[model samples]
Target: MKLLYLSYLNSFKGLSREVWWLALVTLINRAGTMVIPFLSLYLTQDRGFSLEDVGTIMSCFGLGSLAGTWLGGKLTDRIGYYKVMVWSLFLTGVLFIWLQMLESFYAICSGIFVLMVIADSFRPATYVAMSAYSKHENKTRSVTLIRLAINLGFSAGPAIGGVIIASVGYFGLFWIDGVTCLLAALLLLLVLNPKKAKELDQVKNEAPRSAYSDYPYLLFIGAMVLLGLIFVQYFSTVPLFYSEMRSLSEVGIGLLLAMNGFIIFVFEMPLIKYLETSTLSRTSLMIIGLAMTTFSFFFLTIGTWTGLLVIGMILMTLGEMITFPFSSAFAMDRSRSGRQGEYMALYNIAFSISHIFAHNGGMVSIANFGYKSTWYLAMIIGVMGILLLYALRYRLQTSRKK
Candidate 1:
């Protein structure tokens, strides 16, 4: 037990204090992530929204994410990461309070759109700050640390949210979520202090570089969008499966969802660290990750038992553990010094695209075609992602030789 515990500490050792603090910020921000994970359920059960209605509202969030990602990328480069992070965090929390009061479909949808725009704009700046603070060798691990904190918070959020809904209902979820967003921003302000952000290891001489012009990077982003389409099914459609098909209760579904985060928390860091000494190229690692992702849905398609659900969750999470952090690290490596934020923002746009596909397409598909059909789509998309990511290896290799 002591040996195991000591290894975990050794993994985190040597990353800067700023990196750890950033991870704390991620933890605080995600712990209140109650609104989205439970959104379909809240809309369907409480507000009596049809799947289509929920889909449309989510599409609004996706639209806002697209707009916000672009705007955030531009702003991160122009305004510096500190100001962008501060305002994005503060205003996003304020918007959530506004969102809680609105009732009409259009009103709520509009509110969600604006809220996502403000909230997601923080992402590029956050990436910029991470790149600024992280060392070259530890870049992927830095992203992983933040992801670890996020998953830990996610593990806690739904467990608590299940209670919040059982007692005070969805209203409590929103209020608490808003407070936590504010709390995360406050931590960033108190610890980093916007004025002293310059003390971080920023790229001192950055020439302007356009990410769009990089064809290899563009192809990589395209591959990620397809991968995300497969992945976001866990968020948008899987809950519906456990509810409608598997007959899991609300709390049961929350635990089922928490399984993803808990698995990542346990296995991902150690696995990444182990791969450091292996001969596999980063792209080879991504290929393996995508292959694992492709098969997870196929395995889920086999049966809906508790054992299968556990298996499916484990495969999907291991797939995510393998893909997301490494992909971000690759994007960071491909970026020109000053252009890292733009690259990360473009990479994140894949997420926005998947949100559109996941909510609008995933919901509508399941509503009409059935859950098995949805998993089939996930399987096919994952296959396509693997092929594209395979092609990406050569591009990256060629770039490396240049």
Candidate 2:
């Protein structure tokens, strides 16, 4: 038991100080991520918006995210990542507070769109920073550490968000979310002194390629979009499932969602560390991950037992644990020396596009066919993604041999 504990602790060794600081920044920012998880519910219950209206509003969030990531990528490539990160964090914090003042449907839609645009721009810049800070061998683990912070924050955020909503109302959510973003921004500026780390601004000597021109990468992005559509249901639809189907309360739903984060927080880093030693290609591991994620939806179809929720959440979390960090590392490795920002932007943008579909499509399907049918559709999508990934694997191997 002692040895086992030590080995798990050992997994965090050798990461650079900057990576740790970056994780701290991510942790603070994500810790207040109370708004998005509860956005659908807040719209329907608090604002009295129809499900269809909620879908439109959420789609706007996606569209804004798409624009933000693309802009962030270009800005990072041009102005450098430090300025991009700081500005994105600070501006997003202000917008989160300002978003609460909008009352009408169209106003809220526009607010959510602008808020997400500033908020999500932080993603690719952070990825570029991680690349700059981490040693080559530590890249995946570094990404995992960042993800661990994210999930750790997520684990706390929703549970706390539920309590906050119950106590202070949805209005309070915006304030807390806004404050945290500002805090995270300040922490980044104070701690990650870009002046000391001039390498962040250093030009890569290797030739740069446009991510748009990379064919295999485009296919990989497509597969991720499919995977993302399935995965994002947790944020958009699964909460409703707990409330309407299982009759769980807000707190109950929060705890259930937090369960996903807790499992990942505990298990993911160790899992990634172990996988780092394996001979299996990253694509093979991704296929395995996708299979688990697909089966999570399949688990939902089997029974209405609340136990199935826990089971499905576990499977989904595990699948993400395996899939995300390796995929990030894979994307980073695929990026040319100077174009990491563009490559990572497209990678994050794939999820943004998925958000556009996942919320609207999942909600519309539930309204029309019911939740069970939606799960079936998600499973089918997951299967198609798995096959696409398999094809990607074959193509990558053929290229290597050639």
lDDT of 1 by residue, 1-402 (tens): 898777776776667777888889888888877777788898889888898998788788789989898788888888878778878888877887777788889997989889888888888888888877877777788889988887788777888899999999998988888888898889899887756643345575446678888887787888899988888788768878878888989998878777776777877887777775588877888888888887888766786577888787788788889888888888877764437668878988888888776666887898899889888888888888888877788877887899
Instruction: Write the residue-wise lDDT of candidate 2 on 236-267 in tens digits.
Output: 89889879988989988878877777777777
TM-scores, each model vs. reference: 0.88, 0.88
- Judge candidate 1 against the unseen true structure and give its global Cα lDDT, from 0 to 1: 0.81
The clash tally of candidate 1 reads 0
Which window of 10 residues has the lowest lDDT sum in candidate 2? Answer: 197-206
Which residues of candidate 1, in runs, are more than 4 Å off? 38-54, 165-173, 194-201, 204-206, 239-256, 303-309, 363-376
Candidate 2: residue 202 lDDT (0-100): 38
In order, candidate lDDTs are 0.81, 0.87
* All-Cα superposition RMSD per candidate: 3.0, 3.0
